[model samples]
Target: MSNDTKARMIDAAIDALQRRGVAGMSFTEILDASGAARGAIYHHFPGGKGELVAEAATRNGQDVRAHMAALPGTTPAAIVDNFLAAVRPVVAASAGGGGCAVAAITVEPDGDALRTIADTAFTSWTTALAERLGATGVEPAEAADLATALIGLLEGAHILCRAAGTLEPFERTARAATELIRSRYPHQKQSR
Candidate 1:
């Protein structure tokens, strides 16, 4: 009911969602993970896992948007490079071993809530990237397409990296992304 409690629930849900695919997850698991009682989960998410997941998905989406908004650039390629750099520590810390929550949930069967969240997050991320791209002279729709490609590459790379337990997949993907970005905006300078 309280803002803090709601935030805690979302945090716990995010952790659980990341670790377990949506449908396979349970209310008991979330309660145990967050150390909250059934009443808390009910009070915050009466519809149970689906509601929590939807909220979690929105939270995650907002996080990505925040990162994009916080960027100091007016260029699409620069924003993406910064985003990738920001993600590097997370990937390296896990030894490149974890698929993205959005990507994972998108694949699981009957995880409509999870899938919706994933789709929304990815869409928001691409939208943010598209804004940056437009600032750098890319047409709005073209920027959106570019943003989608970048996200797809990043998400797919994360999955591969996790499966291989190696950073090579990520590095390779980053290299290709950099190249694609450069080819698309040859005159644009890369952010340090």
Candidate 2:
């Protein structure tokens, strides 16, 4: 099997995890979503669905980490603003939340290893976010806590928006996250 097939399978697995959670995500759905040869599943992921799910969840977390690293701005407030600017349009254009893959696995990890993977995914996000905030004048310890709060706000916003089928929750979350940064570090004004 080609690497392309493996990547597609992983991507499909991520989608399944987000939409269906671990208990509901199925190999059949992964294969159908990916358009990968059924036989390729075993060839690509010998450890089976659990292994595939773990990899997908990790990838989802890393994808967001990469996005945060690339967000524009050299200050906390600006970072928050730029990040919101990038995601707001996508959130508005979508039918609703994209659903968080890591959270899906987190809520229903099938095994101890899967649980660890979920924790790693969450920690990866906080660590990446903390690094960004810390670089921009926020104290390291405060940045870490702030990062966790911001991520918590984001996840809560996603759930609320998905349930309500509206962007108002996200708008509130964006404002809240921005206000939070402002309150915590009133010294770091928006760079843009």
Question: Which tens-of-lDDT digit does each residue in 1-192 have in candidate 1?
Answer: 477777877887776666665766677877776777678987988887778878886887788777765655656678668767877765653343444556657876777767777877888888887777777788988988887887777777676776788878778888888778778777776664
Instruction: Assess candidate 2 and give its TM-score to the true structure.
Output: 0.89
Q: How well is each residue in 1-192 modelled by candidate 2, as lDDT tens digits?
A: 499999999999887776677888889998899999889989988998878988898888889888867777889888778878876754553325467788777676347777787788778878888888888888999889977887786677667777888889889888878887778668766695
Identify the candidate with maximal lDDT.
Answer: 2
lDDT of 2: 0.79
TM-score for candidate 1, residues paired by index? 0.84
| Candidate 2 Cα outliers beyond 4 Å, as residue runs | 89-97
